[model samples]
Each structure stands twice: as C-alpha cells, then as structure tokens.
Target: MNRWFMTLLASLGLLLIVSGCSTKKDEAPKDPKAAAYDFSNEKSFVVYGEGIAPVHTVSPAQAIVLAKRAAITDGYRQLGEKLYGVKINSSETVKDAMIRDSRITAQVNALIKDAAITDATFKDGLYSIRMEITMSARRWHELFSY
Candidate 1:
C-alpha cells in the first residue's frame, strides 16, 4: 500500500538522521584534578621502620625519610620480627641494610605519588626489604569511583 511505503520510508529517514547525529564523538574535560596514573605494573615495597610521619604534602624528601624510617622499626617486639633469626644486638652491617632499604624504597616511589609504607623488622641474618604498591586515600578512592 502507498501509506505503508511512506511510513517505512519515513522511519528509515529518521533512523539515518539519528545515526548521523551520534557519529559526533564526545571529548573528555581537561583538568589536572582529572589527571591520573595507571598502576597496573606498579612496583611495591614492604619496609621495617619506626613509625609513619604525617606529612602535609608529599615529595622525594618525604619519601626518602619514610623509606629509612620503615627500614629499621620495631627492633624486637612482634613474633613476626623474632622469627627472622636476625640478632638484634649482633654485628650485622648497617650499611648493607641501608643499601637494601634504598633499593626497595626506590621501587616504591616508582609506583604511587604518595607512598604508603608499613614497618617490619624481621630476624633474618640479612636485613630484609619488602616492597608493596601504595595508593593515597584520595587517589585510591577516586580511582574506583571514576
């Protein structure tokens, strides 16, 4: 019927217009607040330090201090620390420990803008350096929501 053909033609024309309009792509807003770092292959570190310092802002200086502090906390307290078999008063080389600590910290800084660290002093003969990925609370929470 003529009416049926007209109806079909009109529907096809409408669909074509709608499809053409959708071809225009939307762009993302530009803002540093929207800036982000991908941490899929991000390095991580586990350290043994005294305590975490509350820094107002994060920087390389803060990272270094935090790394060193984490490398030598809790001389002999937790059962985990005692299990390492490292003698607390023994003559192990502090220089060696510092070197290992630095290596681990470097890896951590490579991951997050604001590093998260925990202190663990184990009793192992050689000073232990553990690495873990850190995320700031703001960044961490923001990542998921976005």
Candidate 2:
C-alpha cells in the first residue's frame, strides 16, 4: 500500500509539471488597422509650402494624464465604475495600464478605418494621444451616426 501511494503521488507530480510546461505564450496581436497603412514607400518626406503650422510637443507628465483621461472619454468608462467613482486600482502598474490602453487604441483604430487613423503619438505624462486621421465628412457622419 505504501509503495502504491508513492507511485500515485509521483505520477500526479509529473502530470502537473507536464501540464504547466504545455502552457502557451501570450501573443502580441497584429493590428489590422496598422496593415492598412503599410506601403512600399518607406522614405516618405512631408513638403511644406510655407503655409502649414508646426506641430506641438507634449511633455511626459502631460501625456500620462491625457492617456488616463482619454481612456475614459473613448467609451472605456469601466475604470470609473468602482465604489470610488473613478478607481484605477492603486495596485495596477502604470506599464500594464499603458499596454492595455495601447491595445484599445489599436482596436478602435481598426474599427474606424474609414477615418484613416494612421498613427498615434503619446507624450510621457498625458493619458491622451495625438492621432493622425483622415476621412471625408460623409464617412465621419456615417460612422458616428451609426
């Protein structure tokens, strides 16, 4: 009986080890929205006719704040549903939040392909990002109205 029990315990341990080793790695998703922007022209340059204004630069602190705020504004109101009315769990790391936020932005960009949301740039502190999007008035109306 003692030998049988030892054999059973060893088999269970081996099974658990094998099962754990078979766990798959988490894959980073390829964004379909990004696929739309892929092209052969890699060294593209913007030509200014001395008419366009320069772009603005946002600081890191401002970027983080903007990112958090934009996450809420862009239909992700789940963060605010906790008892505190706006509870971003203190235990959650900023890196984890940023990764999730980036994924959300990618998915949203995919759905709004007509808008041609080509790219996004984030400053360090801002929760919001500056997005480059192109779309006709008709397309915009159709998207939001639907």
lDDT of 1 by residue, 1-146 (tens): 99999999999999999998987455443665554443333333343434344345387567545644555333222222322233333232357446323212111111123333343333422233343344454545464454
Q: What lDDT does each candidate get?
A: 0.43, 0.40
User: Weakest 10 consecutive residues, lDDT, candidate 1?
Assistant: 102-111
TM-score of 2: 0.22
lDDT measured at residue 36 in model 1 versus the true structure, 0 to 100:
45
The parts of candidate 1 lying over 4 Å away from their true place are 27-67, 71-146
The TM-scores of all predictions, comma-separated, are: 0.21, 0.22
Candidate with best TM-score? 2
Candidate 2 weakest lDDT stretch, 10 residues: 44-53
